[model samples]
Target: MAARTAPAQPAPAQPAPIASAVRRDTADAARWPDVARLPAAQPVRTAIARHLVGRALHRLSLLEPDGAPAGATAGPVLTLHDPQAFYLRIARHGLTGFGESYMAGEWDSNDLPGALTVLAAHADTLVPAPLRRLRPLWAAARPGQDRNTPQGARRNIHRHYDLSNDLFAAFLDPTLTYSSALFTAFPARFDSLAQAQHRKIDRLLDLARVEEGTRLLEIGTGWGELALRAAARGATVTTVTLSAEQADLARNRIRAAGLADRVEVQLRDYREVRGRYDAVVSVEMIEAVGCEYWPDYFTALRRALAPGGRIALQAITMGHQQMLNTASTHTFISKYIFPGGLIPSRRAITEHADAAGLRTTADDGYAEHYAETLRLWRQRFTTNKDAVTALGFDPVFQRMWEFYLAYCEAGFRSRYLDVRQLLLTEGTRR
Candidate 1:
């Protein structure tokens, strides 16, 4: 009998059409060698890609090792590569990856601001098809309650500004003020952030039309700089802050400057405050109130001001045409920095103010001033990194802070974010 031929080995199974499609969809996202080396039964590459593509593309490029890109895409373009190590570093680490990736010669882009502008403009394209299905589910699961109460307010302020006074002091000007950007009517020779801040205070005073012996109230009195300036100008000042630490520091500063009698700093929520003042000024605090509370905030501001009193509000406004949660800036800010912060469009703020019986007297944009301000802060922070670290901040915390500052600078530089100063008055005033 002839020897039987060995049974032919079974042919490998071909991937189904659906599986092939899924693989193609994920082919553009980066996958770590460690992840790739895992057993074939566990496929994390697809999950990673799904997560990445579902969000907005911040920046994407293919680059050589010498900080020169082979090719670059400015808008929401998908990144597809299997970088040996450096590019993978940025993929693994989020914002912190940016500085490291740039410094390591892993990537380069000639126009970061342009790239950001394109990313922001095309952010809506990043949403995955599947995320639409989960929207209703998420909405159903989300609590109907609003978390913008007084205690919640203080907690939110503490999360961001109260991290360490020393850290802020190192970067901020001599006054230690942190608020909206400073503006000059015509560019002047003032050469410092402190001077710029002084100019901002002067502008606010001028806009508010504060008279000698007039009563002034400041909401979110960061570092008490404005309050002190107002008091120095002979206006009686009352200021409030959510941070106990800030209130303490401001109070001490006020006492030291011999203006304790003219200026008062209180650790109190804006909503809980009472009494009427000649003018009301709020800077940088509106963002923390969240858009849901805008109506209430305006109501409270209205109540706190005497009839005919002027109100000046300075804020960083989201662009008029931008959509919420597409780029999802609030998510990042809430998680790592200002937990309850929400920047609204100028239209939103003005509408709420109008609804609350306040008439807008003036609306001005200081978008460029913010870029200069942030640049100054970044320089100061970078120059004082050792002092910042000496204050007991860990590397992760430092990276987070640096990323926050630098990204803010980039955003302002790109006009993806804007700063606005609005002067308002009760119906009786104008």
Candidate 2:
């Protein structure tokens, strides 16, 4: 046999791009670049390589559309995996670049959560390498886009929820319940997640003392699940949501259910709602309102409820009083995920409620239930991944959603997050 050529030596990996020079491009240009240009930062590149390689080396490859090895560098590395493009912005401008580049389709990935896990796991390397200088700049820039402001809230709500009604419908249950924890009462009986959600609705209605012909007000009515359930129970319900898609779908669902006579959904802000009802219920919506608004939120509920009317509020609360490192997680969510959302502590909520002339009649912590709920959601989402992609959600969105569900599940399981249902009355009920 002819002497075999020595096994070809593997080519040396390229470096990452400099964080400052990553230019913003149009969506199309971002999606299918002929070559990837990276920063000259060697240490950052090495760190990124270590992170990526540590996760799943077999699945990792850098290539152009033609399958040729493409050049990649640190500073701001761009990855093109087809149908998704991701720009790793490693500088102060990187945050804006990351968000805008994704919107522009600058890079793609088949595995979003895995990519994030790699990045997050090596956060010490990924962050603080060159982005710390922007802290003061970002802090100064924050007030302008805060959730309490109308522009910020509207921007955030539109960015995520307004992506598409069809997309949400693909993953969400028929009722479109988007929030936290479904209390199944008897955990063993409800074999399906949807059925568990239905049971949770029943429990909430029972707790609210909802009766036939009773008027109900729902704040942040995601997909109108609770409102629909209340209407089915013979209660007249009015639900409000900031998402246009949610409002439209909820309206159609009500009509389809032939409950239009009693159920109405409005695309409106919670602060803007005005009316008195027999009962007011808010689910998983309080987090979107910053703690600065907690007093206002409770006061709004008091004003919205008729005397002796009951109010039910369900929300995710952290166990601690001080802000934790997870504050960065919240920041990322606000910047990329929920926008203008803030989870409050148990103390903050109860104290603010009492201050706002409302008494907490009952406080139920259903931490385990929420953990189970998230587990079910994550499983369903993963099992239906192909269907979800078919609905036009990109890999980044998929990753974000997966991380959201898994992180939430882990949080509840670890008591890092708590699910709370507080029954409130305008004043002490005689």
List model 2 lDDT by residue over 361-422, tens digit each.
88777766775666556656766777877887655556456656654554665556778877
Q: In model 1, what is the error at residue 367, expressed in angstroms?
A: 1.0
Local distance difference test scores for all models: 0.63, 0.61
Off by over 4 Å in 2: 1-143, 181-190, 322-330, 428-430
Model 1 segments beyond 4 Å from truth?
1-118, 121-146, 183-190, 320-323, 326-330, 428-430
Q: For candidate 2, which ten residues in a row score worst on lDDT?
A: 10-19
Q: Pick the candidate with the highest lDDT.
A: 1
Q: Write the per-residue lDDT of candidate 1 for residues 1-430, one digit (tens) a residue.
A: 1111222222112111100111212222242222212123223433553346333343233222234354444322222332333234433433333334332333333433334445544544544567544434322221223256776777778877888889899889898878644644222224567877887777888778776997999988888889998998899998988888888899999999999999988888888889999899898788888766788899989998887789988888876656254223324445567776677888778788889989887877766577667656766776787798799874445545654665575566556787877898886234
Candidate 2 vs. true structure, TM-score: 0.68
- Window of ten residues with lowest summed lDDT in model 1: 13-22
Angstrom error at residue 72, model 1: 11
